[model samples]
Target: MSGSFRGEVRKLLLHPYPKRARDQNPSREGFPIRPPLNNEPRTADEEFASDTLRRMNEVLARIQELEDALDDPSQIWPRLRGAWKRAEDEADPRMSEIVRQAREISPVLKDLEKRIRRVLRRTRELTPLDRVQEMDRASMLWLSRQPGRTIAERAGPAQRILSTVRYENFDTLENRVFHSYVRLAALVAREWQREHRQAHGSDRFRLVDTLRLRCRAIACDLEALGVGLAEPGTTPNYVLMQDRGYRTVRQNWVRLLRRERILDDLWAWQAQTWTDFAVLAIVLAIDELDEARPIAQSPIVWRQEAFKGRWFDQDRPLAVFWLEETGRIVEVQARPEQPGPLLTLARAHVSLRVTDPTRTELPRRIAVWTPHAMQRMDIQVGGEDAASRLSEIGQVASGEIMRDGLILTPAQGDPQHLVASRGKAHVDVIALDASGVSLALGMEALREFIRRDIWR
Candidate 1:
């Protein structure tokens, strides 16, 4: 028995059976059986080989069950413990590989949920411009805490005085303007975070400077109208000037006071504010440049597959797959020469039409790429010839179309209800007129460009 067991173990460890041995054994009886030789029967090697194969399969089946259990997320810990037990019992090399793979996948699966939530929140925060204006108005109410006070009543004179302080011959206009606005912003942002101010970059100073200048300008305007600051500024303190300026600031105050109550009622007529959109436009400008870098590196023809199935190309380490309208979009290895279809999906889905026409003599031009081949046909669409054609189009499209006049107006007044019956409307008007060709080719792209880059 011991001799047979020793031979069986040797066969299992050393080598596989030969073709003759394989053909001879119809059924392995936990050991191989040689066919009847002319004189000799079976060798100990054949019997051992057959028995070892049967035992190996049994071991494999057991290991597979443990692997399946380990893959069950609910039983992962128990499966891991079980796998370790089996590994300890069997002392096999394959068990270690399974354990290592499970450990690698666990952390990856755990973090995926966290990453998805962050992306969703980011998308939610990037809503359209209308929402931003509404938020600004809401912020005013929240800040002032007085429903009766109009924005102009509160911020208009303050804004003018800030402007006055900025330009005032205070010996160091830049330094004074910087610190004065700094002080004013300190008051406005007292409860907010240092991070908020940090994020505003130049705007923190600009915000304060603009406010103080506006207040100072208002004070000066009141002086022009024969009104004086409530207190003379013999004091060195800027706050003293600020306080006096606010108290004495006047701008047809009687009309303002009478109509201040109506400010609440006039939301329906308030001009669509462009400040928020302006900020968005600036961000989009950066986005455009960043986006263009890759395209400029290696230009590829990308078409939008919008009508039927949607596809995106993602580059994987191994290969790039041209994903089609199937529910599952697979990552593909990108070719060296061309970008995949996924690359142009943004152009089709998102609008990036640029309307600004800087001089052709200058290095950069807007709308470098347009959906319409005609608009993109020439590199210098805004060259003299193009500009001339655009000017003609602008004249025709120049019919007055009155907009919400509030945010557009420089000074305080009831929001505009007038139509742009004639004359150039704004920078946006000219850009759109020029984009008429591009718009005909792809309105989505043109609208996105105007709304984000120009109109805003």
Candidate 2:
């Protein structure tokens, strides 16, 4: 969860670049070595070359992931093979040309073997998951070190263009060329990125366009990380900068490329900390907008009528929904103990019932509790027995609602408002937050649970 070997492999097709050195590659047209010329149209050969390049890149990424996984040979090799096969199936004539040049770095097998052995050895010497946690903490520290900026600081014409093109899907020749460059830049940037694990820029691959490329890479990386977790065995145990020796190798690679006048902005950013949170925040906000509903009014606060004590709940969605539905009336308990920004909402007195994301209207129930509102409880979908069962599972006590007042916080602001409230006795309060939906047990699931006697 902490490190990024998982990210490295999964992101090759989408981002191919490091977060800091995107768009940093020198123009292919102006390279000291003449760019290859194909007088013929994009034939099978050209397509095959492109496919090979992509495949090799993917194989390299798999090697990185396998190394990070410490060659959990039972699991990782099959994955690597799958990656290779996928890349090969996608290959065309252009991919073949790309394959010819790929050996310039190293044969795929040899390079992969080297990277794998290196990563395996490093994993043997260090605890990957712990280091990943450390790296996560480090990334947080890096983000905190920078002053948080508004979206306006970074949003400009480029964003507008990209947004437009994102919707349009770049069909023009110029756009296609640009897309190719972006893809190539991404892979090159990863080379630089693999070196400097810090979140800043590097010196080895500085084009005027580098920052945007890096941002693209990071965005792509995060996106891939999210997708990889959706599948099993794709998530690796290690973070990006887990090994000091790997860091040294990255540094040396940059130093070697320094004479080529690349990697400056990227390396600098790597050594110095900076935050693209303005960009990331915007994207995250956009993502949330698609998933959450806005609560319109604040609910009445109530005393602890249903539940007695305030305690912690790890179900983020459940906790978030509880607060939005019920305002502060009970002796609300606490806040997150970590050192980043804080979010405060009300507590859940009743259980919230809902269906699962993987299944439509498949009923389930979850107990919700928060720091600000204690008496209110929310459930997903279940009966009293199911609620009791889930409550016991969550380790929170059932509470009584003593009084009611509008004292809760919305995700966007500090105003205390009850986003949702149900008048029915069977359903106490249902609130939907950015994280999860809080509601009562649906009748269907309740009947099923009763018929099956599901609760133990």
Candidate 3:
């Protein structure tokens, strides 16, 4: 019985898979079925390839999103940071490429940020003067780095001065005089800057030195006219300092007024008074500059009649003169009409005369009439053959009239005639008759004539 039990146990252990062995080979038991050794089945390899491709597509999609975000200026830094962090932790080699591109673009992004901040600061600082648009902000940014604080700071005070002068309410004469002063100031400032740069070559210099000598000369003139300067070491209380030339002018004017005990009169002064004084100061300063040159042989006058009584009338002449080198109007003198008072006054009072005939715009035709001869002579002033015409007229007349610059001849035909001349910069038309010469046809008249005749 013991031997039979042992034999049963051995049979059970040896023949445990008898059913599977009966169906298949005993060596194949507990082993997987496979394709041939040389040609493995493609299913597993295909599945693994598809899964890898899907993971790569996801990575590529994330990279594309990151690239698109980096194109924006505001998004550049943020995307770069995120990309750098991802690259540090990532095992993917593609992340390293993205990190390299981000580093390449980092410098350009930083520069753009700096420029934007600078422009914003400038816009904020300049907001008090005017509504600073983007273009104005850019201009201010560029101008802030210029030589002086003039352009950067002067606009506000200039506008304020215009308001104080009541520019919008100016009359014809006042407007002309005011604009002439402005032009003169601008020209002087430009020349001053040029000369300063040439002399100093980027070395720092005082803004006041630009007009120091000129201002001193004006101060001397004011002192001679019974005006006094403020005490030395006194603080300069003037508010307008943006334009060195303008501030110098205003300061001298104030000193003159204070010394004359007429400071309060400025508020009550006529617009014409303001115009005359301002123009006079600017002309004197410009005359002292080395760049100025005489432009006219005789001052061009605009004469008109002012009625005094029922039968009495006076002829007023407004003389205009300019500098040849700068082409800037330097002097405008108004006086009672005489035979040739402008030339005499210009020589005696202002030391300004027209020496360059080519630079001056003389009347096209200068007519002189003698009551005894009862004849009007037309003297041609400007043309291709102006010199010969003047010589011919000079021979026909007695002699040169008015400072030996003008020639007069007797008109044989008509007593009353029209003197036509090509208009110059400020002088438009000049009409000379037996009584006097008239330059009343100024820029405004010419514009009106153009609007009526030429434009039509």
lDDT (0 to 1) per candidate = 0.25, 0.25, 0.28
Query: Quick one: best lDDT, which candidate?
Result: 3
Off by over 4 Å in 3: 1-264, 281-352, 356-456
TM-score, cand. 3 vs. native: 0.15
Q: What is the TM-score of each candidate against the true structure?
A: 0.14, 0.16, 0.15
Question: How many clashing pairs does model 3 include?
Answer: 5
Model 2, stretches more than 4 Å misplaced?
1-209, 212-456
Q: Would you list the rank order by TM-score, best first?
A: 2, 3, 1
Candidate 1 vs candidate 2: which has greater TM-score? Answer: 2
State the displacement of the C-alpha of residue 205, model 3, in Å, after optimal TM-score superposition: 24
* Clash-forming residue pairs, model 3: 296-354, 297-354, 302-439, 376-411, 377-409
Instruction: Write the number of the candidate with greater TM-score, choosing between 1 and 3.
Output: 3
Query: What are the RMSDs of all candidates, in order?
Result: 40.8, 30.7, 48.6
